[model samples]
Target chain A: MNKDRPDRTPESEERRAVLGKMASATFAGLMLSGVLAHAQDAAPQKTLIPARPFKVSSDANQDVLIRMQGELERAMQKPINERRWGMVIDMRKCIGCHSCTVGCVMENKLPPGVVYRPVIDEEKGTYPNVTRTFLPRPCMHCEDPPCTPACPVGATYKRADGIVVVDYDVCIGCRYCLTACPYQARTFDFGEHWTDNAAKGADGALALTAARAYQNPPNFEYGKHWERGEGIIPKSPVGNARKCTFCTHRLDQGMLPMCVSTCVGRATFFGDLNDPKSLVSELAGAPNASVLKPEAGTHPNVYYLN
Target chain B: MTRNTKILWALWIILALMGGIGIFERLTMGERLAAYTSYVPWGMWVAAYIYFIGLSAGAFLLSSLVYVFGVHKLERIAKLALFVAAITLVMSLLTIWFDLGHMERNYEVFTRPQFHSMMAWMVWLYSAYFALLLGELYYALRRDVKNLSPREIQEDDRKLKRLATIGIPLAIAFHGGVGALFGTVSSRPFWHSSIYPIMFLVGALLSGGALMTFIVSVIWPEKDEAWLDLLQFLGKIVLGFLLFDLLLEWAEYSIPLWYGVGPEADLVKFVLFGPFWYVHWIVHILFGVAIPVYLLTWKRDARSIGIASALVAVTFFAIRLNLVIPGLVTPELRGLEHAYVDPIGNRLSYHYIPSFFEWQVLMGVVALGLALFYFGQRYLPLMQTLNNREVSK
Candidate 1:
């Protein structure tokens, strides 16, 4: 054997491959940390500007809700069409905490059969090296929504300001739109209460009272206060297909979407995409930004950052 | 009453009682008792609705052959077919109306319908068809409606034939429109095919013809030599439609699955080999197609053909189930089936099994149909017409 090369075995080659993968993964982690650091640095300066006449100077380094709330107020002053509302969700920052889901439920007074936003948890790889990923899904509100045309009753449609809405009063509850959706974002209202069966058992009366109070409150969805109840002709949502509207009624009051304000990771961004200086515009215009199911040709306004 | 009649009455009473409970639940509780959720909205009722509608279309078309095309051999049963068609049409409308979120708002289709939807078009076409069907049935029964003399009988026949002529187009349009309703849904990859409408038409012919054959053989008042001849002809026609329907089904299933690709491929495989694979293999192919085809071809008699046709009629519901459920069972997005879980409400998950309450409602609809048929047989001169024919001979 030539002594020039010392101990170059097949085992060494296997080790080399494993080492290479580890190096790449570490480099990727470092790159993500850099991006997060940059985001933190840029946030405070944007928050310092006086967004409204009655508002005091908000610290740029304040919570993401305050920054986004300011952005929402500025966008509301523009004409509706000139305001192309969009959302940007950064996948890297999401903690899978489900705060957004809970916040949405509370804000909408969601009944048992209805859910406006849900956190999807996906686990990748197999054993020890496995990592978990969380994707919180809301309605895409597509520019060319497949759901709208599929509705025989013309109950659901896309607004000029880029929010898709369902007219509960007009909806016949045919559920054709539910099947048409590629994202599976829509759910039907089956007119159930959380404390339905509890009312028949021990300590059930108190639970029932709490449920009725929580459930019957006026939910300002689509700018109308809806007191959901069970009747011969139940209200709009009770017999209709429902989905996320980006909290349109809240937007009318110059507030950010419930999900955007409630995200624990501050991963969600919301503002008019038309406004070049808006936080959502900057994030959505980034190269990493992408939409779900691009092959579907839905042209969704919701963008995701990896 | 004979043994068969006694058994039928017993069945009707039991079903009616059960169905009453379902009706009560539907009236008081609304859609809360049903197993189908927002994810899988349509269930057994929607399938039953299409099944009854298809049967009505098929029976009406068979009647058209005798009245419009002047098939003298099938003339004796022409009135019978029209009556069966009308009953089935009523049942279909009732089932679908019950399926509606707001049954009272069904009149909205007539008032505020948007023409772009195939559903709207289907409803309109069927309403027209329903009108034509009533008109045709009335004319067919004109001899019994009045104490008509022989000359008047001839006049009634002319009116009946004219009404049947108008009914031919109405039947075709409404039935084919039902197919188009499913076919035009481009979002549903499983249903969005040109052949769906055609498949529905052929299926209607097979199932409807078989049902009529069963009814005629078992219930015909005259078991004379002519009755045997009538049964033989009806049996042959049913066999022909069944074979044609099978051919269309082959084209429907095979073409989509040939390459083992496309969104439809997995869904078709699920129908053929999934958890409910028996619905297609055992219920549809074995009982509906194979056994019936064998009996018709080999037995070549009224009794055998009647039994075979009845089997085909009952098993044909499996085909309708396969068409409706599988189209909706699969989640449009991957992982959606597991995204949200609702164990009690049954509205969150994509997986669907029709609740027992749903079955009860269906039973009620069937009992209603049977009761209607029973009353029609007793009060109407349906059986007397055959005695008159014998007397004339």
Candidate 2:
């Protein structure tokens, strides 16, 4: 045995690993405590303000609710640091045939009553000089999403990757998000299916692959849910809050969402928005493109080219 | 079991039948019953959600008179208010769930909290408010049990007291936060007003107080003490909230009209006077505000109070609708296709109608609330007025 070498006992190795973990945890905790303590010390000091002449503050000042809710406004100003997922729709190019709506339905397999996409037809001008325009709509996935705040459980969130997603299992069936959404872009899966009869091969068609479902899936680095029939079984039914995920299941396989792939006009494009080299980047920079419902402050992902 | 039971049952049955229609529209026609399309994703369900939200806020405000104001004479009605608040919250949530396309992934609220999202604030606010209500309820009950011997108390008095105390401040936080849910939106002109939260709070108090008069009368408190005082207290609360709500509305309404509002802001105006004018007229002004004010505070007998309350329950849900739906229906741009969103951020939910299955689920939730109220009132120590059954003229 080399004199420089320490003991070869298994217990020492175990102890070393344990010590290493403890050191890392302690470091993290110390850093966290320092941050919290600093924040506490830096709490905003209250300042006196002039009272309104006629307005009665009453107990209804709502200072508490407002103070507690400051985080939301803070979020509104959180600054889209990373390539904030955005979209550009060219209003001039839309042909109102309901192709996007039809394609979305065929791709997403939404229950009847629920349309993942739609062609909004607008009649402009009056009398003989009237003109009509069709605007296709999808979730804006707002930078300051109204829907996200309404969720009681915080089941939905925006990913660093720039997509808004919902975690199905934890949703308590409260649809606050539905009401909170100003875009009216969301849908509720009211627990209804193709049919209520559960036993009659009632697996309900998996829209991921159609043909009732897909099979013989390959493992992808992301979402790994390659097989349509072999995807991870979520504890939710079709009736839960379901919306578009930009085909994350497909994105994992280096593919685009079904709707994007099948767009008859090749109107939709998909890619990592952060990389300036990406096609969406070039399109976003192009002056002819615009996004739907940009006024809602929900930075959407779907762009349109006129 | 009795004729009274039969009457309540009939009311329930009628309610169920109405809800059944919503369910049918939801399941069969999908976006058929209502014109909810992806371009206009929300419809009746969003309106219903807002309505229930008003009711919940109103109910909570009513409960606060007894809790925060130290008016324990109004105490007997407080628990019922709390229960009603809980029930209406469930109804509001059910409405939203039925409106979403991927109601399946509605989980994101809990798993993901968007600090910036007004929707997220609502989720947290409601949760915290629920907690607060539960806390105050326990506190209200705690002293009663404490004064009595250990044998006379229920199983978990200590924990109950702790929880109830926690709920007191939470109720205020909850409704205010709910107001902020809409107020935080800079896009929709109607919702963008800073006074919206204040409007919501006053509206809650107004509706809650109005509801209490009716609920108190229905129970037919034959021998309860301070019946007169309770009625008087409720009148004041209702009048206060109503005036406040009206003033806020005046400010909210005139501001946009005065300004050369953008296309989105004009949409709110459209909702108020255009296709949705009826809702503004019948639901918001007449049924929600004016009718209840007249019924609750008018020089009338106890029966009028009950009817007024039942009406308040009806109209408060309506007021919530006025708040939620109108803002949403207004297009984000001058012209856009999708009006609503589904759970997974899909544009499809904008066109949802409550299916029959959705209605069944909603009915199930409502039934559950009713059952809870019935059983809680019957078996639990819900009311101090239980022993005194008569409301003297």
Candidate 3:
């Protein structure tokens, strides 16, 4: 094992203390049971110690990301259909920085006029009594999704894991699904570009070339490389109906969604709902947890903790 | 050609040329030039489509009066009406085809149709109706195809009658299905009503009958007493339907406006008093209904009736426009429009007005329809019986 560095932070000290407590507890249990007595006598210097890859905190709420990461890895071992993906956003912790929204756009390479998630800023009451609230709206990935049935070509459907996905290749871009969604989660890509109105080489070719280069890279959505094309007969996702997929491509790679990872206040949590110990399942089980437009009867998998 | 015919040709050419530029832009730019955003998904093209399809259904149903019900006074224009129906159906299909994001994949609706979707059902119904229309049109023209025995003529007439009987219900189903397409979208309260299918039928009859009356009064070759009498009969039918249609409109508008509280009420108020209020007040109420009602009731002459019918037929587009756009202007969730702003694309906005490109494409559709009508009238036996009557006279 590598030696502990001298330059230690308070968080590292807390983690080391937690680890030491766990080690002592395990040693006491093993001594009482006499399971490791023979091994301890043979190799007194080397006791069988458990491997702890993630930093442990004494307070359960302090290392939520680390806990959630562990849960995600455990859930990934299950079959795809058995794992029901879910999300929970704690609105009290959200500062409305819009970092999650920006992260989603960057992660998916969303074009202009198309968005997967947007935080709604609403002001309630009037004058002195007014209070502002932020509600981040993403695709509910409903159990009974209305948008899926509205697809005339059977292009959009709910996966076995409860994620609603659009088959970009099969989508006819009718925009019927856009109207069908009560939450207005779906948006059609009008095949627009950031540099559509920018002057060609106005400040020399550097800015224009860089912008083009940024747009040229293929986005890995649904585990497929999608290179956005220009002109009338646009590429698939450009004309297809798009919505949030809970970052399924990332989830498959044992990584959390971009929005969940980028949330500064740790407001967003994502994991398999089938696992009762998952962070999302725990948050969603709370009495304050609810969904937007419950009257729509969509039975959304995404929950918001008020 | 007459001076009127020459003027009509010049107008057609001008419209086609203007629309060509818009069509070119649409083909090259995709939906970039369209004013409709993700918020207001349907726009002028959708309205135009319903308008043209209503005309087709109405014209076909009018022809049913001649073939199925044996209304001999309407016999002279029955074939002409069928031709008009077929032409308008083509125009509606073309207009809607351009509205599709993947126009090439339209065949997928047939190959991989999801029956739960009303749009898929409507497309299937339209295909069935299109085939039935062709069959009916062929039988109606078979007697006039060349020299034929009297027995062959009688046999063709029987086939025509049978086809018309089949077509009447088919026309109602497809047109009513169009209304149901909007009606079944329970998300939009304005369109979610049982009355929509009936309203669409009434509107079709009024608009389609007016167009037929206008053609008979103004464009028919013969100007004898028989022609005048037929025009008067068509005028009375159109006027009755117009009044009935108004009563339905009143029911549609007033029932929701009485409370002025729900989502449907807000949409109704928006259609009446919104920024585009003139579309309903000046275009539809004034030109489409009031002026036509006044002329049809007061003057009663062939010239006056012709003008009235023309006004009603042309301004019915405003009625269609009101039906489609207002249902979509309001956001489903409050403040959702302000939540995400697409400054560069301007496609996240709730507000929508048909762009110049949209109107230009519509104008092109109308021009194409006019061209088709002209060619069909010139070459087909649409007016064979009427010409034979004139020759004998």
Candidate 4:
């Protein structure tokens, strides 16, 4: 019970702290190598074959046009900083497959009730004008998050890299922030598991990533820490609130979030918003791009193109 | 021994019966203790937590009038009310924790301490309040210990005075802090109102008076003139608090309602006339406030007033439900069909129902609180001096 100790050797406490730091660093290092390697091969190489493209602005005049031209030149010449994690969803392409939910579930090793992403099926109008739009919801990874302040223990927070993560070990399972969240984006870990082969879906690789961890290692970030073919699912911290981490572990390993890649309709886009050359930036600049619930003031990072 | 033992046996039986139902549910339908999801995440237990917290604050404040201010007539039931308040507050916190998905990780509140967390602030306030109330109780018992002729003070008497002495102000801070929690949430128009803690404080005092009045009548049926005079004075305070609470709520609602602020105003409508409409009008307004006040003042009859006070006590829980739930149930989105669906995907016809086990644990907790209060009063000389007759035969 004596947590503080001259009674205990200083070496013991020092060893424990060192071990904790090393464990965390090893995980981070693995993530860095995975991501950098993936980025090298996967990043699209482009030839800057010079072509003059004109973009129109309203109130084009001698002075206005000259000022706008100067602004455009400066914008094109600016150096790129850190990549901002972002997403673009094309409303036109969504087919309501629920594949995104499945991919998220598998990648994150979520519980039965805890889904990191869900597809909202919207049917428009009466019979004559009936139109259904599938809205896929991953964590918005809000720029101004509501869930952050509500966490009494700071168990949930946004990472400097723009990912929102939960500290599973520190979460007291008091779901106050869960209620405080406006998007209904959070899920409770009810100590659930896959009973039988019910969790087995069509994709073989997906099954491995999403396999139930019966005694789940405290995976605040997801990776296959559990050995393959163990058949025994380790339980995560069962009683805490959980949500999407914007695929942090996968991003570290130079991969697209499982959901974005597995989308049958290819409706989802993921990339650095800060990079001018990123495809997501181009799509987000389109006329129809919009974020969900702008009134919420949470300033969501996800954009949906209608 | 005969009557008291019989009462104790009856109380124990009641506790066991309620606990049995809780156990059955946890065993049988453990996975499905009524479900919730990200949308409609909170429910009855959260309300109940605030309810008991309110009661504790109310009771402690009443005791402070005696211990801190030395009001002689009110002193009779000050200790009794304080004892009930303490037990009730504990029951409240326990219910909410039991309802948590991550009950095991509850320690994170202390470990990480999101200084920004309103619930965390409330937790600290509640604990500090509990400590203060315990101290106040201890201090009140100083005279009792002095009268014990230096035989190391009776264990029961010593415990009460020592705890109450330190705990009185702490109890106030905890409950007042609970009020502050609701007031601080700038979102959720219903809860974000600045006057919320004041409302909570007033409500607690009103409910505390109501509870003590009922306890006296139930446990000791024969009412004397001295108790009746005290009862009348308490009734005035209760009704006055109720009047102030209504004014605050009405003014808070009117700001958005008059503006026709669509979804913002919609929450007020939910309480006033939507799904939970009846709770607002009937339980909070009618049975909770009107009938009790009417019986006390309009009737000007002590028996009727005591009966009304009992009515207020019995119905206070319903009032708490109205305060906590409706604001939470309102969807942040205006139109996401089933955006505000019961977390279990509307499998049950009712959006949210407190499950059988949930009820059992809750009932058991309530019974336990009452039992604690009863045993506490019996052992400690909390009652006013009457002829100095020996309580023990």
Quote model 4's TM-score.
0.76
Model 2, residue B254: distance off in Å is: 3.1
Task: List model 1 lDDT by residue over B161-256, tens digit each.
Answer: 887787777777788888887787666788888987788888888889999999989888889998899899999999999999899888889998
Residue pairs whose backbone atoms clash in candidate 3: none
Q: After superposition, how far is residue A89 of candidate 1 from its true place, in Å?
A: 2.4
What stretches of model 1 exceed 4 Å from their correct place? A1-71, A199-203, B147-163, B383-393
Considering DockQ, where higher is better, how would the candidates rank from best to worst? 3, 1, 4, 2
Better of 1 and 3 by DockQ: 3
Mind giving the per-residue lDDT tens digits that candidate 3 earns over A109-224? 88788889999888999999998888888899999888898889999999998999999888988888888888889999888876665446567466667667777788899999
The residue ranges of model 3 lying beyond 4 angstroms of the native Cα positions read: A1-62, A200-204, B1-6, B386-393
Q: For model 1, which pairs clash?
A: A44-A60
lDDT against the true structure, per candidate, is: 0.82, 0.57, 0.86, 0.66
lDDT of 1: 0.82
| Candidate that scores best on DockQ | 3
- Which ranges in model 4 have alpha carbons more than 4 Å from their true place? A1-83, A193-221, A224-235, A285-287, B1-12, B20-35, B145-173, B183-189, B220-222, B259-261, B334-350, B386-393
Query: How does candidate 3 score on lDDT?
Result: 0.86
Which digits, one per residue and each the tens of the lDDT, describe model 2 over residues B266-342? 75576577766887788777876677678766754555555655676566665665666666654454444333234
User: After TM-score superposition, what is the CA distance of residue B141 in candidate 4 from its true location, in Å?
Assistant: 2.2
